[model samples]
Target: MKLLIVNPNISTSVTELIEAEARRSASPGTALTLRTAPFGVAYIETRAEAAIGAYATLVELAEHHAGHDAAVIAAFGDPGLAAAREMLPIPVVGLTESALMSAAQLGGRIGIVAISRRIRAWYRETVDACGMHSRLASIRCLDEPLADIGSVQRDKGEQLVALCRAAVREDGADVLIIAGAPLAGLARQVAERIPVPIVDGVSCAVRQAELLAGLAPRRASEGSYAAPPTKACQGLPPALARLVGREGHDNENEEGNS
Candidate 1:
């Protein structure tokens, strides 16, 4: 199986972090391709940054999705997940959604930890979209500044573990998800310290992408996930515009139109 992971942030260092975790998590025969967004913020921690990241994710996917069996939007907020899934035939999973689902299955209440408090609201929206908000115990994030976007996992590992423990104790959380693109692989590094299961967004996302690739579910032709109507798109990359316009419509759809 082939998996493509697109980090919507412009930081290649964070994508490398995600690659390390995905390499450790994916199946033996699975090949992983990781891409960094050509344009966007260095880190996506707020709703506005995530909104830009969403467009970046789509552009990355549009240009490079060929030959991949499945794809992952490797940002915690899952910036363009549904839109990507609707626009592409391959299964597209989101980092936070996969981690949250994996954590929910492990225990009842879910706790999420990120590097910044600004992301709390957006991550909350993700939980609600996944229908896991009711099961959420808390969303913990640090309010202070950090040295680097790519080094938070190493710089703040202990701080993150403490937050996890507090979530379990103070917030009554039964399971935890370590979210954000920079913290992609931190869960494994700190899992032993935390009492409950600590889910890694990168790990769960790769496995979920692999599972969906193996299932090879047919693309929806008539539902909400169905290929959307072809329409005019302006000021976008050519490849993305083609996809937006459904320029490569299959014979069946063309025949129907005829």
Candidate 2:
């Protein structure tokens, strides 16, 4: 199975971080391709960055997702995930959604340790939309300024273990999900220290992408997710206009973009 993993942020190093973790977790015969956004912020901590990141994600998907079995958006925020599902026929998985669901399966209550406090509200909204608010124990932050993927990986294990311990002990969480792309490998580092199950979204997302690649492609419903009506725009780029005017998915390529 072939999968495309899109990192919405513009950092190539972060893209490598995601790819490494994904490779470690991917099942046999699963081929993964990585794409870093050519446009957007270096990291998505605020709603404004997520907004631009989301647009870059869509454009990345359009340019790189032509022949992949499934697509995984590597960002925990899952920018453009819903829109990608609507635009493309293949199954779409987001890191945040995959982590939450995997965390749900491991235990009852779920706790999220995010990279920044700024993301708390947006992450909460996402969980609520996924209908897993009842299962959420709490969302906590590391209480530090967000750093690049490389910098965060340097000393994040200490803070991660501390937060995971608190979530399990105080927050009444049965499972803990380490949120954010930069916090990818911290789960394995702290898994032995924490009693409860700790999930890394990158690993969960890769495994889910492999599973979805083997299943029958899900068709978009005729209502809200249906293809946009053909229309002409006055000032948008020609590619953007063509994408807007494009009709429904082919639905014939069950094996992906091939």
- lDDT by residue for model 1 over 24-56, one digit each (tens)? 999998999999999989998788998999999
Model 2 Cα displacement at 176 (Å)? 0.6
Candidate lDDT values, in order: 0.87, 0.81
Supply the TM-score for candidate 2: 0.91
Residue 256 deviation, candidate 2, in Å? Answer: 6.1
TM-score of candidate 1 against the unseen true structure? 0.95
Q: Indicate the residue-level lDDT of 163 in model 1.
A: 92
Per-residue lDDT of model 2, residues 99-146, tens digit only: 999998999999999877888988998888789999999998877775
Q: What is the TM-score of each predicted model, taking all chains together? A: 0.95, 0.91
Clashing pairs in 1: none
